[model samples]
Each structure stands twice: as structure tokens, then as C-alpha cells.
Target: MIKYAVHILFLILVGICWTPAEAQFVNLQIRVEPELSAEVQQELDFGTQITNSGRSQIGLGDVNMGIFSIRAYYTQNVYLNLTFPDALIHSNPAIDQEIPMELSISYNNSGLNRPSESTPLPSEGGLVAIHENTTNLTSTSDIWKEMYIYVYGYIDIGNIPNGEYTGDIVLTVDYD
Candidate 1:
């Protein structure tokens, strides 16, 4: 029993002496960098601008149910015009939107506005309907000093208007 006890004590001592080293007392530092991308659009013909000066191409697919809403904003009275190709019905410049007055819509597509589609443009003059975006716009124009405007629209080419008109599309967004 005495020899056995001695052997066990020796074994314990050997085990303690041979023990592997353990990592201890470490100083660690960490940091985080967030990545972000955002968008804003002005020219409706082109896609919305995303973060900085990036541009996205706009197309028919973006129009929902063939209907579109556009807006324009200017500090003072501005001249907004629509044009028709020379071949179609004679255009009369007298027709225009008066102050606080912004845009004019054919209500329907005047096929003449586009290429071959000569069908009368849908009549949207008397009652112009522009759908509003439910989402609150987060950006502001105070930074850019550019006019902001909005217009409700649809593409109805089967019906022609008094004359084919040319119009510029506008999209309102929060950023530059």
C-alpha cells in the first residue's frame, strides 16, 4: 500500500508537470463598417438614380397597369408643353395649363404621340387623376432647389386626342 501510494503521488506530479499550456490574458479589439445604397429619380425617361450619381434605366415595365403618375414642381410659373408630330391634326398652342397649373394629359393615348399608333388619344383633360405613392418620401428638395411636380397618367392609345402632343415625364423622389 505504501509503494502504491508513492506511485500514485508520482503519477499525479508527472501529470501536473506535463500539462499542456493554456491560452490566457488576451486583448482583443473589434470594429464594424456598415454598407449602404440608396436611390432618387428626376428624369422619368431614365431609371431612378441610386446613391450618389448612379442611374437606372426606366422602361414600360415600371408602369403599373399601363397607368402612370407624374409630377412637376417650380417656384414660379413655368411653361410646360406637349408636342404632336407634324403629320397629325394641326396643333394649337393656345391649349395649356394656367398658374398653380402644372401639367396636361391626353386622358387617353393619342396613338399619334407614339410611332404608328394613330388611334385617338384618350380624353383625360376635364378630369385628371394622379395616383399618389402611399409611402412617405424620406428625402427633401430643400437641398437641391429644384422644382418638384407630380402628374397622374395612363397609356390609352386606341383613342386619339385633338392633336398628338409631346410631354416630358417627371418622377419625384427624396434624394438628388
Candidate 2:
């Protein structure tokens, strides 16, 4: 009986003396890259035009056009969407007149200066897959590609009130 009690006390002491195991940790790391970017290199300007009795048109080849540049990962596909205004309102607050306008866009993945040579996007806007040849590598380590966008506008001037008119154009871009 005494031997058994001593064995139990010895086991209790051994359990109380035991220490917890050590904990281990590891270091984790990651590298974040830059996001895609777009910028308006040139503003769309119609300049000064005298309204005639009939409809006045501005072709895609017109001098008054907008230029935009987009940059993204090399060989990565991106989508572009454009929201166009229905009309251009007169600058005068008192003038309650507006001219009906239409807008069109074109793109060149090759970054060519020729807007006419580029592919014409729908007036309603749609997705454009960046061609492999259109990529202009901006960096080597963190590879980046660039493309150009051209915008044109046309207005119907049917003996409407002549004054400075303006509208907004919104362009949205995202990775595919």
C-alpha cells in the first residue's frame, strides 16, 4: 500500500514538472506590382465652327480629335468602354438650346500616329483584345505595354442657336 502511494505521488510530480513545447514561426513575403493606367494625352477640341443651314460633319480624319494612352502588363488583354453624351449644351445659361452630337472611337495597338489606319470601335462601345503586335514594351523587368486611342465627334447643326457648346466623354478600362 505505501509503495503504491509513492508511485502515484512520483507520477503526479513528473506531470507537474513537465514543460510546454516551444513554438516555431516562419517569415512570409510578397512583391506587389503596379496597376494598369490610362491617360488623356490630348483633349478633344472641335475648335470654332460656323453653323450652316444643314448638318455639319466632322470626319474621323479631322484635326480636332482626342488622343488617349493606356498602359498595362505586357501581352495582357484589357477592355475599354466609352460613354458619350447625347448632345452638347450651349455655354450661355440663358440659352436653352442644344445640338445633337455623335461620337466614335478607334484604337491602334501599335501606337501609330495614324488614326485613320486604326480599327474603328462601335459607337456604342465594345471589348477590344490587345493584339500581340500592338504591345509597346515600356519596361524590361516589370514588363508593361502601351496602346493609343482616338476619339472623333460629329454634330448636327440645323439652324440652331450658335454658341459655345460642350459635353463630357467617359472612358472606362479594366483587365480581362
lDDT of 2 by residue, 1-176 (tens): 99999999999999999989899898889887666778888887766766764455556667768889887766667777789779888888898777788877888876456776788877666676554463454458536667778887777766667778887779877776
Model 1 earns a TM-score of: 0.17
TM-score, every prediction: 0.17, 0.68
Tell me model 2's lDDT, rounded to 2 decimals: 0.75
Cα lDDT tens digits for candidate 1, 6-65: 999999999989978888897998863212111233223322222233222222323321
All predictions: root-mean-square deviation over Cα? 19.8, 4.9
- Model 1's alpha-carbon lDDT is 0.30
- Range of the 10 consecutive residues with the lowest summed lDDT in candidate 2: 129-138
After superposition, which runs of candidate 1 have C-alpha atoms over 4 Å from their true positions?
Answer: 1-77, 84-144, 157-176
* Model 2 alpha-carbon drift over 4 Å, by segment: 1-33, 134-142
Error of 2 at 156 (Å): 2.1
